[model samples]
Target: MRRDAWWVPQIGAFVVLSSFLAYATWAAFQNAHYEFGSYLSPFYSPLITGDSPHAWFRTRPWFVPAISPALLILPFPAGFRFTCYYYRGTYYKAFWADPPGCAVGEPRNSYLGEKSFPLILQNVHRYFMYAAVLFLGILALDAYRGYWFAGPDGVKHFGIGVGSLVLTINVCLLSGYTLGCHSLRHLVGGYLDRLSGRPLRRKAYDCVSCLNRGHMNWAWFSLFWVAFSDIYVRMCSMGIWHDVRIL
Candidate 1:
């Protein structure tokens, strides 16, 4: 087969996404420095174990001291991303070589589609969306927490730091991606046979449709920012760098 421009992007996507997966896996297991001051890594937000402030609430019976809190929460978001409509198409072509691109030939002679065992699990994307929505709430709360810091005088004050801004932007981007999900759009208004009669639902559908148009952009933006937010918090927590105060 003749090579084309598509290969360039396909290769780039594979490299970048694979690198992220490796880093996330390593970070999740480390389970340290996920929270620094008010900044918390998105990967480990809503922490349920280890050094989490809420650890006294009764840790998971299966929780191990050596394991990272991120191990408990990363699955939901990971599942959502793995089965996302856009991501399915992306990794299929880039990583699986399931047609690679427009004219690229695939090695397999036949396709099983999503009816098979593992692929059939992709059908659970809608359910994952529900969990994803809940996670958005948790991340938003973390971002809110980022805005309050304690002073040397032991007085809590409303202030902003570079990490605070980073966490805030991460939540916003993640919200955009989660809200713009195809399953969410369908849930909002896709079932209606006559949207004209329901102005409210119609309006909601329109809003989601607008967001859906940029789903791919939101996907990449959220992916990078989430990792960046985690790295920023980790650096600050490790005392390798200091969070710059903005307010």
Candidate 2:
């Protein structure tokens, strides 16, 4: 009775997620071409230690292994997404076929839900939400910095470029996703029983709820844009694509 190609969405999720994972892994291993002028890849934002002008530290320790700076930062966002409530159900259905489609039968008899090992690990999502919020601030700064470029005399001045807009849009999308996190919603207002008593908490919770309603949309769009942001910076750095300054 319910045979209307319900598996299409699951298959789409599998392919997009799998392909993004592969591309992100490959891009993270390439240490170079992650920066061009003032444009920095979201994957390598808050540049810890490197030769780039954006690096927080001037030098890398000789004892440290040669690895992409992205590895140091990617874990936080990756963890947040991996433990995401939406993603958990997505992969469970799409990849594991726990219930391939609506009205479909489960492969196993017992349903442990998040009570099981790997799924239980998602309990840490609240902690990752904290990290994700902090990252929003950092990425917002990166976007602001994107609007300023070095002048010919080696001085920085206000300017706008394709990269700047790219970074800005990425930050907006990321904010939508990170702010809408279920854990954050609970932290902000879930603890209280009466929102009418606390105006501040009520407002905060309302804002978060607005975005939470579209969590799945925010997640997918942000995922795609962040990857595209990295690609844009990398291409510009490699001279394969040009960063056209508008200001």
- lDDT against the true structure, per candidate, is 0.88, 0.91
**Model 1 poorest ten-residue lDDT run:** 54-63
Note each model's CA RMSD in angstroms.
1.9, 1.5
Q: After superposition, how far is residue 145 of candidate 2 from its true place, in Å?
A: 0.8
Clashing pairs in 1: none
For all predicted structures, in order, the TM-scores are: 0.93, 0.96
> Per-residue lDDT tens digits of candidate 2, residues 4-123?
889899999999999889989889888889988988899998898877888988777776456788888889999999999988889889998888877887778877778899678889
lDDT of 1 by residue, 1-247 (tens): 6765878878988997998899999999897888898777989867765446535345455535545678878999999999999999899999989978878778899899887987988989999999999999998988988899988998779998999899899999999999999999999998778799889999989998998999999999999999999899999999999999988
TM-score for candidate 2: 0.96
Q: Number of clashes in model 2? A: 0
